[model samples]
Target: MLTFEHDYTRLPEPLWLACEPSGVRAPKLIAFNEALARKLGASVVPDDETLAQWFSGNEIPSGAKPVALGYAGHQFGNFVPQLGDGRALLLGDVVDAEGKRFDVQLKGSGRTPFSRGGDGRSPLGPVLREYLVSEFMAAVGVPTTRALAAVASGERVARQMPEPGAVFTRVASSHVRVGTFQFAARHGEETTRALADYVIARHYPEAREQDDPYLALLECVTRRQAELVARWMSLGFIHGVMNTDNTSISGETIDYGPCAFMEQFDPRKVFSSIDEGGRYAFNNQPAVAQWNLARFAETLLPLMNVQGEEGVELAVEVIRGFEAHFDKTRQALRIAKLGLAEDAGDTADTLMDALETLMHQGRMDMTATFDALTHYAEGFDDIRREALLALTDQPEAFDAWLEQWRAAPLLNDATRFDAMRLANPVVIPRNHRVKEVIDSAMEDDFAPFHTLLSVVSAPFDESVEARRLAAPATDSQAVLRTFCGT
Candidate 1:
């Protein structure tokens, strides 16, 4: 019965027309982020029925505005004239216990005026996929959007196959994206500055202290994005898509479709079925991030204080630092994965190159290869050594690399090695495993879904009961292609 206050109607001009939801009949609650719910000062409502009652367009939460946000995006290489929240509605921004502002968004809530003649509903698979991978990313130390909850829409929506529907409770620092600017600037330069001002007041207040807040905003986003792409590489994450709309200004991971973790250590891995040209491949993510940041820079050009060419040069310089920053952070992360904190200079790359070569030649287990290294050095037990031996046909080659690794002055004592394993996860949600879970869920079996969640929740520890999670699937279960649920 708590009605949320909304002041959007008093905006400088109409942002979006008030619209009702379509394509939703019986919305059901699937899951809730208790951590984020407490952060947002929201309490649980009980069962899926209760959640569905609220989301079925039959009930509206008071004090929350069901407003659609406006933003444009580049689909591939082409720009769309306009794109906004088609199936999503903002339930308003909530301040956390620490006073940080975060937006509460509902995906598949229903349709808005932006629906554009399509069914504005999220199928169950993508909802579950986002919940799985987003939570996994957070556990693995990556900055990303968090899934608060998922609810089934007691209704079914038609996609490749007719499927039960669901809604996801997504939490983010702010919904502002690079595409957000593209929308505003296209409206007018005044609208552009206004949006930038709102962003500064809301997220980056320190930018207001600068001489040129708008340009400072651009620089801040670029720096954060550069470092974020670096972190992704360090963890072997492949975003699969780098569209401008998919880029969040808050630097938290957003839009969880078609994303996956690398399995074979291939920098050129392209898991998203839509990425035919490998534009956003595993190795290309860093460059793609720089490219997106460059677009952000171009959007902020009107506020740039420097002359034309010089401003462009400064933007180029900032973008140039992306690769260097990515390399530096990834190298440091690579060292920690190998159980060493200090860099071994060129030796680190040398050993990494050797590992990649061995893994590629032997078709090694990507996640386990780095993790097993620590166990081999620490336990020295046959089980640990055997784990390493199983990775490839080239134990002699790996042994040679391990000698160089073990001889490199140990950065930490044996106890520190134990701590490093905890830092670097041994298990990740592999594509094949994700596919298996999805396949089961498609058949209305939640057992596999829950099983995957349990194993993925603690990716570092290897329980004998959960040993299956550590092992790659047999050759037949190998998943070579992943698709966008669209």
Candidate 2:
């Protein structure tokens, strides 16, 4: 029953100490996430003037503290003791009619205790990138943080260049990260145990009834993350930054900076401008999740039992299941795209090999190649297969690959068309196209953004106007490096 201005002092004790809002410069109103705001049953759209005040730091909402919740993270390969919401502040948790909880926070709001030397503001380009990318991710059935609204903070943020500024009201299951536990664990056993108990009560309430609640929490998070990363791989998503801080305990993908959907099926594809070493490449994601989970395990080790070594041993055993869980989910997705029902005796490896060869040789459009094949077989046209195969240099590879594929029973199934449509999306928010939308919107020509947003919103449909969305970029137009607007 908090009003919009109860002040930070009366919120959570962790957020009690904080500076007041120092309104940002150059504030402007950009976009409102009508869909997400409605999901929260929170309407700020009719109150446009107040949006500028709240986003630009001219006002702080009720139950919100201007505090930057603290945590530690492994940035790239190194651990930093500090990397909180440097430019953001938690506005407390919002609960829905179903009693589900969500954290509503303002990104690019302003500087905080964790601001360090950074300006603590977000640029409009990244704001659009996140809003578009995150919404598309959510619509695609991927667990992701949703954007509530975006407010242009009549300001400029510096990167290599200056740009117009904005703020996003980002909603997520919980802001708790692997780094959150790491921060507590690194501090001491008491803090680690406290965080673990809090997390169990908040996220995995069922774990509270378990004999070893902390270990149960570890297992729960590991399973959720395994399934989450598998879903990403199924769609060719490479989360450029797989830092512990970016790893959410609620299993949703957060920190969409520098993330890219694979243009081709190369397992080694690395698109993040910040990922020079390819540590978080397409194939490396599962392994990185394992690594990050190990960190989580370490945090909960002290709580596994009264004896430390016993606790560590138990956590490691549960963590080992992460790889197998990811593999099972991944293999399920792979076979589904080819209209192959899950089976034991079938060799999915050979089918995957054929797809890989096609991708490597001719840059065969990954989403389209399998999508087209799902409806085609002996009774259909081998010519369509051949024509589609022509898109790749591995026509010979596709030829060698198709012999056994034609023998695959599901290709002839009456419901193959239905299965294929469900397995393959007709569209993704293509990088180049997304960049175009952002660029056009930046110039105040929001027509392109509006159009693409409309098309990409329903990625499974075959809209005549959206034919462009199903196609790959021209060779010259391929965006090689994606950046995390961090």
Candidate 3:
């Protein structure tokens, strides 16, 4: 039996709306994450029939207190004051055998007050996309929400065309976001402080020990986001939508819609079809994160200090410090990727920038380039070198960069190869491969999806068949723009 604790629903009435998931005619289990289920302390597995009912929201589990969380967000830089969990309901918190707590939520469960004239359903494509990508993110050691289960809803939702519906069981540390704080602040300072105190108690108990608890909370979140975004950069993942609502205070990657892993190493690449202006491009993630944190800080001003002006000054100081923290995290990631034992200072920056410039100029595949370099570093392999050099427009330019990289003092360590192996993943959830999975699943063939999942589950390992999935997209397979299927 699953046990739940409704701490979020215990908050003031305005913070959320108690609701139930809309029932579906038929529920079929599409995928179940047995490992993740075990992690959440499930001792017994339900029969397939019952499992489908529970996950699809056709029947609620015992002790579940469902509530739709309320919040507002800045979508594409436009403030939408009342946007919230329109199609998701936080089922409640479950404590695992390890004594850790997690929130169980059902996305595409149905509409709530926040539905905003929308159907409040998720298409099969996005559901499979989130399930695949979230699991891939977890396997890669990135902080992110995990997919517990996926169930076909036996219903149809009209989008660009009529599509089958699906519900995803999502697990996270907490659903609270930067946008949540903004929503609380809208109610009043009292509401904002209440939310702050609750968040501290639930997520950061150490904040209570600080003289300025609110400021302490801000600093902690800033550090997590800095590290989080740097990790995304290292993996070549673009969040696509960096709106305030999508920014998780828990620092986990949330809202998988339109998110894509980069194939080529262009820092300016954007996949979200809605991101026409490239506000949330690959290189712009750090700045967008800083901007979102600034908004979070704005909501905490009242609780920040006794005087309003003092609070503003304090927040300004804290925001300024975010840059140094992010720079340090990003530099360390770059150093590891380069297999450097010590900081390379200016030489490191020059080489890394030059490699990226070459990638942009040559349209080199991001994952392949890094993996090839790692192989070349471990042992001077002519095959690997030639294959990588072939991707560049000017092989001479790459040869010159290689000379500089070899001359760097930081590469003297005997363990550099192993370090690079750990830093560079041989497989990523390539856009074309993911499209292959989605396309096959739509036709009721889940073999490709399962195979892709297995390959990405061990990203750093070598598998000959998996290498096929790592290839860059062909002309017909290239998915230039990703959509937010709302």
Candidate 4:
């Protein structure tokens, strides 16, 4: 039997509603993360039927206290006072063998009070997408929620069309978000204070040691968001929906809806179908993140050491630091991607800007270009150099930048090569490939899905299959828009 702790439920009742997962018909185990299960100290090896039943909400596990968490969000810059977990339930918390707490959630487990007239279910396409991309993110060393299991409901959900439904088991440090505090603030300052205390105790324990824990909490959350967004930029992963509620306080990439990796290096790329305004474009993530952090800081103003206008000023000061924090992390990642030493200095910035300009002008494939650079760093070969130059339309311009990069001061070829290999991935879950997997899975053929997952699991490895998947989409195969799959 699995064990659970209900620390979140101990908070004010307004924050969550005690609930149960809606049972599904013919729950069949589609995928079970056995390695993650063992890591969470799950010893019982139940049959597939039993596993599916438990995960699909056909049967609740022992010691589980399911609840639909309450939170508000800014949807595309417009504030929604109440936008809770419409289709997800927190089935309590589990502490792994190493003593780290993780929230086990059931997505597509049916409707709760939070479901605003829509079906509280997920299409199998989105479930499989999250499973593949999230696990791939973990493999690539990005902080993200882990997929524990996926079970087919043997039922169809109504979306743009009728689609197979599945419940996804998502494991995370906590589901607390800036929107959580936004909801709490509406309940009054006391509730907001209580929520902050709970979050600090749960995720940022070090903040409690500070003289002003609330301010420290804001600072820590700001730093984490900066680092998180920077990592997302490094991988060309565009989180299509970056609503305030979807922003996790723990800094892990949360909701994977409409999310896709950029195929071509265009800073203006926007893949989300709903985002016609380009509000959450590829280059705007850092600004959006800082904007969300400002919203979070507003929620904590009442608990800060200062009062009224002074407190607002203090919060603004901290929020303004986001740019510096983001730049520091992003610069380090760029330096590593270029396989340059930490002291590469102005040379790094100039080279990165020049390369990005060339890439944007050439409409080069981001992942392929970076992978080629990684190989070139390993050892300068004519073939690798030609391959890198081929990615850009302006070979002369790129060649000029290439010479500057190669001749930069304090060059150590061996260490630089190692750094590049670690920073650049040989493969990502490219848009077209992900669409192919989803298409195959919808027809009950899961071989393509499993094959893609296996390839992405070792992103750094340049295996034959990995190299094959790294190929960019042809014009006809390009997935220009991705849906939320609600």
Summarize candidate 4's per-residue lDDT along 1-486 as a digit string, tens digits: 568999898889679998788898888888888888888879986989999999999888989989999999999999999989999999999898888999999999999889999789999999999999999999988899999999989999998789999999999999999999999999999999999999999899999999889999999999999999999999999999899999999999999999999978999999999999999999999999999999999899989988899889888988899988988888888888888878875677788888888899988888899889888877888999999999888898888888888887634865866778888998999989999998988888888988898889888887899988989999999999999898
Clashing pairs in 3: none
Per-residue error at 409 for model 1, in Å? 3.1
What is candidate 1's lDDT per residue for 1-486, written digit by digit as tens?
Answer: 222444333333324456655536656555655665665666544565665665444456666667787778887767885788888887766776687777767788777777787677888888888888888888877888888777777777888778888877787787888888888778887877777788888778899998878777876787778778877876678887789989998888888788887777776788888889989888788778888888878878887778599888877887787777677776776666666647465666677777787887777777778777777767567788777887887888877777777777556565756766865676778888888887787777777877777677677767863568766767897777776565
Q: Is candidate 2 or candidate 4 better by lDDT?
A: 4
Worst 10 residues of 2 by lDDT: 1-10
**What C-alpha lDDT, on a 0 to 100 scale, does residue 64 get in candidate 2?**
66
lDDT of 2 by residue, 1-486 (tens): 222332222323342236555577655566666666665656445567766676666677655655567778888879998777788777767666576778777888777777887777888777777877788778778889987767777666788888777887788887889998777666777766777777776789999888988888988999899999988977778888999999998899998888888877788999988788989999889889999999888777667754667666787888899987877777777777767756822466567766676686777777667656654632468677766767776677677677776567564457667766776777787888888877886777667766777776787787886777667888888989987676
Best by TM-score: 4
Please report, in order, the local distance difference test score of every candidate based on alpha carbons: 0.74, 0.75, 0.86, 0.91
* Models sorted by TM-score, best on top: 4, 3, 1, 2
Better of 3 and 4 by lDDT: 4
Clashes of each: 16, 12, 0, 0
- List candidate 2 segments past 4 Å from native: 1-21, 43-47, 344-346, 374-379
Worst-scoring 10-residue span by lDDT in model 4: 409-418
